[model samples]
Target: MTTSENLTAPRRPRTVDEHRAFVASLLAPMPAVEVPISGALGRVLAADVVSAVALPPFDNSAMDGYAVLAADVAAASPDSPVTLPVPEDIPAGRTDVPTLRPGTAHRIMTGAPMPAGADAVVQVELTDGGVETVVVHGHPAAGQHVRRTGEDVTPGATVLTAGVVLGPPQIGLLAAVGLPTVAVRRRPRVLVLSTGSELVEPGSALAPGQIFESNGPMLAAAVADAGGEPELLRFVPDDVEVFAELLAEKAGGVDLILTSGGVSAGAYEVVKDALAGRGVEFVRVAMQPGGPQGAGRLDGDGPAVVTLPGNPVSSLVSFEVFVRPALRAAMGHPHPMRPVVSAALGEALVSPAEKRQFRRGVLDAADGTVHEVGAPASHLLASLALADCLIVVPEGVSAVDRGVDVEVWLLEA
Candidate 1:
């Protein structure tokens, strides 16, 4: 059925899974770009990274000690220490390492290449820390302190798999494998629009019935955090013609267009009134604080448009539940959803039986306990700011008592 027909008929609430599946089907990984290792931080790898050279390239000493044949020190002890002449000192990065004689020792520092004819190293602490005439006091077994070549990483081995995120450790590994640049998925570009005649920009004096607009800026920042570039448009008045004109102009340059407010079934809903019968489908999703939803492609395959509720909490929650995952998917992120964990609730909570609930919560990871932040109202932005997680109450359940275990999606991760 067409969107308009569905709206007029008896509407069925869309399940969260159903909505997520729809979103996943719409977004695919973005195109890849070659970027220098220094600029690849936080970007998803587009291809497997194979090591061009082995780490450490050569066998080296694992500690500061004397490199010698293990048999030469087999009988040395504190009472009858064996003394050997240290003809050379091997510090790290020394390329010209001299081979040790049968009865002599070479003083070696950590990470220095092991000289030929030496099978083991006696740690400096066990050898009186000597350099010239080393006084060996312990019997170090063969290969006791030797670091074998290619031990950390082998050449031609896949050091980093595709879809891996490049953090500090990943960057270091890439550098170690001699990768100057890597191919990474491109960041999505998004356009955020907020609609409402009663909306006023922050820092401006509010009239008796005007409230400061917030959803645009908040969602824009959230998009950037999800690895997407965002362009936030000013408040669009409650007029269908103006909203359509602005959307047409802004939608051309972005991968996706997101709008806040004017999506619910109200007479003054500019988004619903303007985009109705134009491709976007308005549905009542079976979730609290973000139930009213709309998504559709713009004219002739223009950027996909997603409509979120106007309330500060609802808009932000909708972005987390829907838009963030979509953006991550476009960026080739392996795990698009936020990290989820089950934790016991610190207090009792109630929810409507027919609708799923997502309430602001503070998770104590140290103790695995989650406390409700405030009332589960869509307009409560203050409590949303303090929340580090979203405590989920399934649609099949009605009320959850204190100490009950519920699934929570971590926001800080």
Candidate 2:
């Protein structure tokens, strides 16, 4: 069944696939912008990056050596070296160059353009260290050690395709092509809100029944890691009117909104109370640690909102399972999901038959085994930090024993 179908039928817990597909339907790539190539790292390309100039641009020497006609050195050997006069030196960045004389050689440095009539370079290591007269001990084939023009890339070629994330390698290529800037999809701006009257900021002294607010910073960081710009709002009290007022006041100029806590069936669920029937759908997804979820666009032209459970692990898992892909989609990334691999479990573990379990795991790549990082409880925040992957268990299965193969989504990649 489709995700929208699942959301509309809230009686049954929706599968992870259904929820994710629904979330994907809510997002599109953000607008494009021309940014300096130097600042384009982690940005998504909006259009194919066509090269304006060829790599290497000209035929140049690949080593510090003598540039010569290959025929002149073809018969030379150590015992009978070819002795030729070096008329001039060619270093990198030299514009003025003279063609090689039939009977002579030129001292050349790496990256120096080859002179006319020179088809090969004999490295300095294979020649006598001479300036006026150089002795070449070895013969070189024609075109040896010469970097031909357009060898790496040609002008007007699509060097990078649209939707590719610009990393260090991509940035270097654009720089090599002499481009000062490139067109890329802008990172989505996300507003993160942690809701609850019982929440307090970290490092502040807490009163009775109060816990430090961790979801705001954690979700913000997750947003940043997913290539979205994040702004964390101060914690909101558990009152529907105040929550609605803040959302209305700050929802402008943002692409999306994320709220943690106040999304469950509790009496003081401010988010549900304020957003119910407004636009959002609260659903019980068939997943452990992140079953309670909500998503919808705001009234008029307001930003899309996603509500996650308040427990640290549940919120993070929800981000990984749903919000991350949505943010990546808005960035124009073609492949938004985490890399997955099949691995054997190191030990046995039990799970609820009705809910898909995403247990924190440490993958031993050396042995191709995965082990649970800590307890399966949703509040185990420290365990999430220790995990490198999420061990996925299907909903129909109640237990996964030692050495059982299962799907694992890598969090590190």
Candidate 3:
């Protein structure tokens, strides 16, 4: 298309919100899969997990002490202790516990099953620490030092609701509930493709016009951090046929195909060239740093595609703004967007009148302000690394003064 044709095109640039929604619509929620509790970390549960057996399973001792009726030691004191004969020992996981008769004590260990007819436990410290004959110098109230059955969790109760992320505690809860495996939303497998003839792998000697490729590793990290499995396809040549062949070979194995670079109007725009009219839709989003974008499936049968800009900052910023949330939403995450807050700008800034600007910044949470980390240039990568948040400037507002509160997207750890 000629420049005049592009300028007099049928429609204007797509808005950021429109493009975000379009990209997100490409990947739907994945079906549930049963995974071992050992591998469920960071995965979202697709269904509510009900407790098969109550936590603790049965009434047990919460302390290493003697089990006795509260009334049996009611009259005991430091000056004059009550003596009782210990006839049984109850250790954790031991069955066949004998019922405690009145005026008799049973030596018990922490987590031991509670003996029948025992209402409380007098700690070993409060007694003479005797195994056969115990002296009770203090009284334990009824239910004290006892882990009652069904108190922590009840059978048939939902221990973890659907859409909850599985962390250490959640995994522990599942194991405690006797679930060796759990049904969770499978993590999206994403293929990251970085295209450029000028790109070379890191740790290699760069030729005159070649530069070390970083986008593939960067985007893959972002994908993994968003709870998706990432596979890297780096240093794709600028030739359309080569790129297309590589994509075809890898598309079937991934839920989504993410590419960095070659979506703009410039020469050798391999992503746009290879994917145009092949089911992917390319458009210039009305956003700074990441204006050129594309989202669709290859040949209508392959995996979804999301093409980002080449500049290091733009590539990462676009992923944070668009791709990450979409991948998360497709994984059944309830809140797909990053945590956003309003903070005053540490300094004044300017933005394009028709583009929403996402500038990297360091958020001063203590001061309730955000400072720009680097210049507005998308090629600045060091600033991107130093930034912990993105300061947003909406379109139609060209400038923001210092102390003016603006929306900020807080980057996760």
TM for every model, in the order presented, reads 0.91, 0.95, 0.96
Model 2, residue 331: C-alpha shift (Å): 1.7
Predicted structure with the largest TM-score when compared to the true one: 3
Ranking according to lDDT, highest score first: 3, 2, 1
Which model scores highest in lDDT?
A: 3
Q: In model 2, what are the clashing residue pairs, if there are any?
A: none
In candidate 1, which residue pairs get closer than 3 Å at backbone N, Cα or C atoms, i.e. clash? none
Q: In model 1, what lDDT does residue 70 have?
A: 96
| Model 1: lDDT of residue 202 | 95
Cα lDDT of candidate 3 equals: 0.93
Model 1, residue 33: what's the lDDT? 92
Give lDDT tens digits, candidate 2, residues 280-302. Answer: 88898999999999988886346
Candidate 1 residue lDDT tens string, 54-140 = 887899999999999999999999998999999999999999998889999999999999999999999998887776888999889
Backbone clash numbers for all candidates listed: 0, 0, 0
List the candidate numbers ranked by TM-score, top first: 3, 2, 1
The deviation in Å at residue 405 for candidate 2 is 0.5
The window of 10 residues in a row where model 1 has the poorest summed lDDT is: 20-29
Estimate every model's Cα lDDT from 0 to 1. Answer: 0.90, 0.92, 0.93
Please identify model 3 stretches exceeding 4 Å from their true place: 1-7
